[model samples]
Target: MRRDDLYITVPSLFRCPISLDVMKSPVSLCTGVTYDRASIQRWLDSGNNTCPATMQVLQSKEFVPNRTLQRLIQIWSDSVARRQLDAESAAANLSVVPSQEQVKVLVKQLDNNCYSSLEKIVSFAKESEENREFLATMDGFLDTVFDFMRNADSDIKLIEQVVKILDLILSKVSEKKPLLESSCLSTILLVLQRGSLDSQIQSVRLLESIAAVGGESKLKLAEKEGLLTELVKSISKDKDPRLIEASLSCLIAITMPKRVKTKLIQFRTIPELKNLISEPNTSVSTIEKSLKLLETLSSCKEGKAEIWHDSVLLQAVVQKVLKVSSKTTEHAVTILWVVCYLFRDEKAQEAVVSSNGMTKFLLLMQSNCSPAVRQMSADLLKIFRVNSKSCLSSYDTKTTHIMPF
Candidate 1:
C-alpha cells in the first residue's frame, strides 16, 4: 500500500511549493521560503531567480537545510503508509463481487430508459477497473445499450451517456465483433453527423477503436454512406484540437482498405488534409497523421493527380521531408517518390527543385534518416538528375557520384 492510495491529506508546510509533493530533504532560501532541495535546485537551474512561493527575487543562491520540516514529512508519511496498509487488509476481507440478481436489476434498469438508471450504470462502470471488467462479461449488456441508442425516442442526453459508457466498455472488452456488425454503427455515424460536440467526439473515438481491429468490417465502415464526408467536414469546421485529431484518426482508420482510398479522394479530402499540414499551429501528431494519409492517397492515380495539380500542395509535400520526425520524413519522401516515379509529372519535378526540395533530399541522404528514407531520397535525386539537368547544377556537390546531369 502506497501513501497515494490513502485518503490522508498532507500538511502544506511539509510539501514543496514547486514539486507539490512531500519533501524528503527540506531546504530554505535567502527569501525565507522553504522547498525541497531538488525542487529548488531544478527551479534555479531553469534560470528562475524569484522564489516560487513568495515571488521575491533571491539575494543569494545559497540554501540552508531545514531539519524540522524533513522530520515532520517523514513522520506524516509513515502514519499514512500504516493507514493505507490497514485499509488494504480490510478491503481484501470484503467481497466486492456483484451477485447475479444485481446484474439482472441493472440490465432491467438500462432497458427501462430511466435517466437515473443510466446514470447509475455509468457510475458503476467508472467506480473501478473491476466493475468495468464485470460489466463487459454480462450477456447482451452491450446489445441492450445499442438497441436503446437505435430507438428514435431515446433522449439526447441519455444517448450521449450511453455512447460514452459504450466507449468505455468497448475499450476494455477484447471482442468487438458485435459492435462492428451491430446497427449501432449507423446510429453512431448519425451521431457524428448531428450529435453535440461531446457526442461527436465520442462517436469518432468509437469508430477509431473499431477500425483498429481491421477486417471485413473496416471495408464496411469505409463503404458506409456519408461517413467519409462527415469526417472530412469535421476536420474542416472543428476548431478544437482534440476533435480535429479524433476526426483525422478516424479517417486514417477507414482509409486503410484500398477500396476506400478512392472514396476519400472523391470526398475532396486531399485539399483539407493539405490545408491542415500547412497550418502554422497544427500539432506534430496531427501533421504526422496527415502525412501518412497523404502517403496512402498517393498510391492511386486520382490521388496523384489531385496532389500534383496543386503546386502549393506539391511544395508542402516536398518541404516536409527532413523537416519533421523521421517517420514523417519517410512518408513525405514516399509521396514525392510516387509523384516523380509512378506519375512522372514534369511540373511536379520542377516544383520540387524550385522549393529547394533537391537540397533537402541531398541533405536527408547525408543526415541520420532511416535506410528506407535514404534510399527513397537517393531514388528521387536520381530522377531529378535525369529529367531536370539545369536545376541539378545549381547545388554545389563535392561528390562525383552525385554529379549534375
Candidate 2:
C-alpha cells in the first residue's frame, strides 16, 4: 500500500470479468480461469457450465481461493481508503484563501490520484465563494481541468470528478468557452447519462454554462446526440429536487431553438411535467419552472395537439392557475389559452372546466395578476361559459362550486 500505488489505475487483473468491478473474493475454477466468487457462483447457479470469459465448457465446477489476488485487492482497497482520508485532510487544511503553494501541491497531485485530488479541490471549492474565486484565478488550475476533459474517454469515475470540479468554478473562469472542445461536451453527455446523481447535476449545470455563451456553443449543445434525451430523462423520473431543478433550469436555458422543443416533446417531456405540476407538495419554484417550460412547449403545433388531447395533463395545468405564484398562474393561463381558447379545442376546454378550472379562472381574474394573465383568464372564462352545457350558475364567483357536468 505504498503512497505511489494510490495514483495508479486499479489493475485490470483485480477486476471480475463478469461484473467488471473490483473483485472482493477471487476464486479459480479448474479451467484455470479466475472470477469473483459471487459472480461465478451466480453464473453457475444459473445453469452455466462454461467459462464466462473463455467460453470453454467446464469439466469440473470445484473452485479454490486465489489468496494472492485476494491479498492484492485488499491492499488496493486499503490504499484507496487512505487516499480518501488524505484528500479530506488536505481539503480541510486549506485556509479561507488557500495559499499558492498549497494549491500547487494539490494541482501537482492530479497526474497521480486524480480522483483523490479532485475530491480535495471540490471539497475546498464548496466551502465558500471566496475559495471558488481564489481557485478560479489560481494559475494552472484551468489547464489541469482542460487536460482532464481532453483526455477523458472511458474513465467514468475520473470524468465524474472532473465535471463536478468544472461545474463549480467554470463560471468564474473567463476563458472557459474557448476551452470547451467537442470532446469535453461528449464527456459531459456521458456523465449526464450514466454518472451518479451528483455528477448528473454537475453535468446539467455545466451544460447551462455552455448554453449561456449564446450562439454556436448553445446550438452545439442543443444538437449533441443523447444530450437532450438525457436532460429530458432526468426530469422524466422522480429525482432529487436539486437535480430536477438543475435539469429544468438547463432546459429553460437551452430551449430557444424550436427543434429543441420538438425534440423534448418527442422524448415525452409533457406528461412528466404534468406529474410535476400535479404533485401537491412540489416546491413553488419547481412548479413555476415546470409551468414555464410547459408554457413554452405549448407554443408549437404538436405541443398544442399533445396538450389538447390529454385531459389529465390539461387538468394539472389548470390546477396551477391561482394555486401557486403569479408567475405560475400566468404560465398556466397562457398554456390553457393556447390550447383551449385560441385553438378552440372542445376537449381541452372541457378538461379545464371539469377540474374546477372555471373557478380558477374566476379567481384569477379577481386577483391582481398580470394584466395579460387576467385578460387570458377572462377570455378562458368566456370560452367555458360559451361552451358549457352544464349549469354555469353553480360556479359561485364568491366561493367554491361543484360543477354539475
Candidate No. with top lDDT: 2
Candidate 1 minimal-lDDT segment of 10 residues: 396-405
Clashes of 2: 0
Global fold similarity of model 1 (TM-score): 0.68
State the lDDT of candidate 2 residue by residue for 114-206, as single tens digits: 787777777778777887898899887887788778774758998888887788888888786754577778888888878987689989999
Residue 64's lDDT within candidate 2 is 95
Off by over 4 Å in 2: 1-98, 178-180, 386-405
Per-candidate alpha-carbon RMSD to the true structure = 13.5, 12.1
lDDT of 1 by residue, 295-328 (tens): 8888888898988888899898877778767777
What is the C-alpha local distance difference test score of candidate 1? 0.77
Candidate 2 residue pairs in backbone clash? none
Evaluated against the true structure, the overall lDDT of model 2 is 0.80
How far off is residue 280 in model 2, in Å? 3.2
